[model samples]
Target chain A: MTVVIGFEGSANKIGIGIIRDGEVLSNPRRTYITPPGEGFQPSDTARHHRSVILTVLKEALEQAGLKSSDIDCVAYTKGPGMGAPLVTVALVARTVAQLWGKPLVGVNHCIGHIEMGRLITKANNPTVLYVSGGNTQVIAYSERRYRIFGETIDIAVGNCLDRFARVIKISNDPSPGYNIEQMAKKGSQYVELPYTVKGMDVSFSGILSYIEEAANKMLGSRQCTAEDLCFSLQETVFAMLVEITERAMAHCSSQEVLIVGGVGCNLRLQEMMGVMCKERGAKLFATDERFCIDNGAMIAQAGWEMFRSGQVTELEDSWITQRYRTDEVEVTWRD
Target chain B: MTVLKRLGRRRLPIANKMAVPENDDQASKLEFSLDVPFPSARQAAVALGSLSPDREPRRGGVHKRLTLTGSVLNVKWRADEARVLRVSVNSFLDHLSLVLETMHAFSADVCEDPHVVLGHQPPSAT
Candidate 1:
């Protein structure tokens, strides 16, 4: 039984998980809520990560009933996060590996979500629709590569949700996406918002501006409630995503669809995707919050696969990269 | 008190400007021109040292007007410390403005021990 510890400090959450032989022993997660009145700031995020990451890691280890020495390998989300936050987690993971003399595996966050979906749903092959605060893409496995068939050209899907929440003055408690979903459910009418899609690439910046303008106007006139606008926004945006996912599935000739990322936790979006998948005879799989949102368990799972293949990062090779393209990682799978 | 060593002068193009006001709607906007090369942080500190009063630094925001035209580096002083700096850029003007504003807010409380050089090369002779 190989014990691998995984560290996830990407974005707003800090997750630590312990895995043994492809099975998760403990999935412990901690999320830092940004202080009211302030959005996501790099300095604040880094400070939060420093304070809570160690506690969460300890919790996972204690729950797994394992010591640091019991862990044979360690893994961490390497990049695609705020520079300061990424540095904090990377340093911690590197220090742990050095102290224990264990090999370090730097996992790609996007691929972690994809692998977690596969593990949870037991899907052999599926078209992946990845949507989150920092990423939006329609991916399919082909030629040993997860090709990006469609994606947002500008701001990510979850980012748009968060920004819209801010515009409508929604309490970002629990999670912004959850709050938005709640508001959307309360809303009844569909407000005509900007619908801009260019080929396989989409732009949300313009739509965000439009919603802000409309919401401000409504606030000025006291015409529509915040929930109505939230509902309209979700309908418009999720429809776009569903449409693209369907197109990508048809294009790839894949009958299975997997939705993974922070936004995958949104039940309404999941329902929409489920409907689309059902009509097309393609199955839609979404991971639970344990793996859907940023969590360490998925990282450990992916790291175990990489570790068995002799893929590890050396101390000299340790450097925090802010922008790591998803396609850059060479997927090494063991039969 | 140990006299701080002075580094030579270096100039960098002030590429963009960002404004952060106490209120959401109100903002102070400044422009940057390509013709003028702004003094590096080291040179700026040296120049400020020479120009400012020798008395112990007071606890307040410093409002100093720049001598250059078409562009000026807008520095906001709060509680006797330089809180924010904005540089203007031509490309992606709005995004750059937001980025600079964020950078300013991030560095507000960071300025300390002005005598310590913060990795800026000195300004060269024009």
Candidate 2:
């Protein structure tokens, strides 16, 4: 049984996960939240990861009931993420690998999400809608590669929601996206926002700007409430996402759609995607927060697959990067 | 001082560490360590980028490394003379403050403003 420990601090969330032979032993995560009206910055998020990583690692080991020596390997996110956070987690991963005399596997952040979703949902060869603060794409497996069928041309869907939450000074505790999701439920009016879908890509910055201006102008005149804006934003963005995913689905002729990443946890998105899938007689596959958000278990799961395929990263070559595209990785584990 | 001496004694991989010389006085290594956390590792790296250009030729008795551990800016400096260490550290802090203030100002006035996100404005330019 190959037991692997994975460290993920690619963004604001610091997660430590342990997995053994395709099963999750333990997955612990911590998110860094800034004050209201503030978006996340990379450096501060990296500090939060550094501060809590040891503690999270200890908890993960304890919960898994395994000593550091019991681990066969260490895995970390080598990303398309903020550089400092990626390096911070990579540093610990390297230290742990050296301290334990184990092999190290640097996993791609996007593939981690996809692999975990597949593991949990058991959906094989599904079209994927991977959405998060830093990324937005519609992907599908083709010729042993997770090919990007469509993507965002500007700010991601989650970034748009989070920035909208900031415009109204909402608490960012769990997430600005979650708060906006809640507010959206109470909205009685559906304020019109830009719905931009260009070919296989979508753009949100325009809608974000339009909403911000709408909030200011409408709120000043008492024509719309925050709830209305939130509702409109969710409806508009989710529709665009669903449309893009459906386009990818039609192109691939696939029957399953898997949603992964932090923003994939949104119920509204899932519902919209579900409706689209149902209309087309397709299935929708998604996992809860534990696997959807950046977490160690996903990394470990992906790393274990890579490790089993003899894809270990040498110590000197484990330097983390910020622009690792999803398709850049050679999917050796998959046929 | 003790930490700096220990750092001096420890043999770090050449790729990761640079050595600082101790002049004739055999003075105890004067060191400065500052930990500044940004909202994300990208911000910390950007701040590091602002200070890293000055450390290129590396021949001075003072040694400095701008590292981002997670999202924190870790400024580690060591020098044979306290004055040299202080000056370098102050200069780094000045650059750091400027980077941070510029980030804040950008986020406050332009980046966060409706007009910025609507376009392809880089954070540095903002």
Candidate 3:
């Protein structure tokens, strides 16, 4: 059994996961929750990760019940994330690999999400919609690369939701997007928000700006409740995403559609995608919070695949890349 | 096991060597020094390799150096102002704590000496 230990701190969530082959041995994570009306900064998020990462690592090893000798590889998210938090994780991953005498693999955070989704959902060669606070893209596997068919030209769909949550003074206890989903569920009215989907690419900054002003003015004048605003926002942006994803699905002409990212767990988005998948005669594969959110198991799972294909990152070349893209990696593990 | 001599473009002799050339000036007066104790010398070196890769691109007002003597990691920082000094020190401590905790976990189960892992042979085995 090939065993891999993964470290992930690309965002506010810091997770350590141990995986043996296709099975998850252990996955433990801690999120740096901020107060309402505020978002986490890079330095603050990094400090938080530095504090809890080792504790989570201890828990991961304890739960896995694997000796150091059993581990075959060490994996870490090499980024497309905040600089400081990414560095914190890379620092630990580098040191631990040295200490444990294992080979290191630098994993792309987006590919981590995709691989974990595929492993958990068993969706083979599906058109993937990866939406997170930092990224939004519709991807398909073609010719040894996950080619980006469509993506956001401005802010990501999840970032729009998060910034709108801040505008409404929503609690970030669990997550801003999760809270917004709950609020949207209670919403009765469908307020109109700008829908800006240009060809295959989508933009959300204009929508976010419009909604921020609308929420402030409407809340002040009781034009509509925050729930209504949330519902409107979800409906509008998810439609934009669904439109582009469906366009990608049409282009790829694939039968399966997989949703993978922090925002992929949103019931509304999943439900919306499900409708589109059903209409297009395709399948929708998604995971719950455990696998969907930024977690270490995803990284380990991806690393396991990479290492199995003879991919090993020399420690000196394992720098944390803040803008590592999804299409840059060669998918050696896949057909 | 690779030592990081290329934090910048240049190379150093040691595996875990990264140094910014010393600049002594009146403006660079704010200085701080810290000694972080680890269980072993190799662990300190691992900490050094782990933490020192984040060299600045001259955007900040801080300059720093990391060196390992025995099991203690020596950190000396010279910044242009007190604010820069404080920020640099705090960031260093945060990284140091992470390294220490990682050591606490793996140092017991894994061989304390990293060369053993790299060489794939215990000293006794050799």
Q: Which candidate is the best by lDDT?
A: 3
**Highest TM-score scorer:** 3
lDDT of 2: 0.80
* TM-score, cand. 2: 0.76
Off by over 4 Å in 2: B1-126
lDDT of residue A126 for candidate 2: 95
- Compose the digit string of candidate 1's lDDT tens values, residues B33-123: 2222322443333222222211112332323332333222343222222242221122112222322222222222224435432323333
Question: Which CAPRI category fits model 1?
Answer: incorrect
Q: Of 1 and 3, which scores higher on lDDT? A: 3
Residue-level lDDT of model 3, residues A202-267, one tens digit each, is 999999999888887998999899999989999999999999999998998899999999899999
For each candidate in the order shown, give its overall lDDT on alpha carbons: 0.70, 0.80, 0.85
Residue lDDT tens for model 1, A210-282: 9899988986897887888888888888889998888888898989988999999888889999999889888
Tens-digit lDDT track of model 2 for B1-126 = 232232223323112233444644564576667666555555555555444543412566788877788766677777766777766665454345434433433233233434323112343533
Model 1 bad stretches (over 4 Å): B1-126
For candidate 2, the per-residue lDDT at B31 reads 62
Instruction: Give each prediction's DockQ, rounded to 2 decimals.
Output: 0.02, 0.03, 0.45
lDDT of 2 by residue, A172-281 (tens): 98999888889889999999887899999999999999998998999889998998898888999999999989989989899999999999999999999999999999
